[model samples]
Target: MRQPDIEIYLKDGDQQAVTDWLNATIGPCTPWRRQGQTFKCQAANGAPVTWLPNAVGKWHSLFIESERTPWEDDPAFARAAFAALGVEIRCAPGGWQEEDGIDAADRWIKINGEGEQEFIWRTQ
Candidate 1:
């Protein structure tokens, strides 16, 4: 199956923070199991997805990956989760072609709070 172009970015929290939020809300939709250094879950299509606590290159980032589904499969699920946590967010739809001719993120989520923080998703 071809995955949709979807990705999620978190700007205000670390992996544990995001994980706790996910597990708290919509966890019933899909539960996660902690692996050695990451949390693992399966998409509705049975494709594996992972959430890394300490992403090497990116600090305090949580990523979602699945072979069968785009990260945007259920954005509302995430929005609701964030809302439940009282976090304000602004999302920018991805798929923008930059002036540099480089492919940009498929989606960009900006957290309205202290510190300059945002998350982006790139899908090809």
Candidate 2:
């Protein structure tokens, strides 16, 4: 049960706390899309980033947790924010393996405790 690297794309004018950023206080899927299978995104001041495909399942909900103290942490805000964004979070387990659709269809996101795992958020 290993977690993937979680890269975050913050906004230029975003001066919020780290937890706020993870909570999606500014927005959900900063530079999100619903048409194409793959797309690129850029932060307010950073360079461009890309999202191939994180997972499949009509994109119900999304959440993040720490592998060390996952159970001890509270993801209420994240869950609510995701719901507002149109997703339905069902479960969240850290230190797991996942292969998001970036390489394949939404059928990826396999939690195998391996390589580069990140969230690569967009704000532009």
Candidate 3:
């Protein structure tokens, strides 16, 4: 089976906020580990999930394997998840962003709250 794509972007540089959002959004699961500043976790299905901290900007990103992800097929759940985190999700792109003017097989989401963030999931 092909791996699904799901990405989450965060606005601020607070790692705890991201972890809180994940725990609240995804439910109580395994605890994420801190590798330096980034957080990594494994889903119940054993899919590797990671939350990367910002290096150049305040934006943070999350990469998850959507095939076994809890909210892959449900955008509402994802949106609600973010909403619960106190962040508003503006655009969850079905494909690539028009402003980027790039072509790719990845899916993405655009967020506008606190700080700008994005999530990209590779479909191909």
Number of the top TM-score candidate: 3
Q: List the residue pairs that clash in candidate 1.
A: 94-106
Which ranges of candidate 1 are over 4 A from the true structure?
1-5, 12-37, 43-47, 56-59, 66-78, 87-92, 95-100, 103-107, 113-124
Q: Which candidate's lDDT is highest? A: 3
Worst lDDT run of 10 residues, candidate 1, spans 1-10
TM-score of 1: 0.44
What is the RMSD, in Å, between candidate 1 and the native fold over all Cα?
6.5
Decreasing TM-score order of the candidates: 3, 1, 2
**Candidate 3 weakest lDDT stretch, 10 residues:** 88-97
Residues 2-121, model 1: lDDT tens digits? 334334444444545555665553342257787787677754555455666435334233444443432343354336535655454444443344663543444455544452344554
Cα lDDT of model 3 by residue, 19-117, tens digit: 566566555447888899777887656667777777326556666765666564324434754666665443344434468554433445554455444
Among all windows of ten consecutive residues in candidate 2, which has the lowest summed lDDT? Answer: 6-15
| TM-scores, one per candidate | 0.44, 0.29, 0.57
lDDT of each: 0.47, 0.31, 0.57
Q: What lDDT is obtained when candidate 3 is compared to the true structure?
A: 0.57
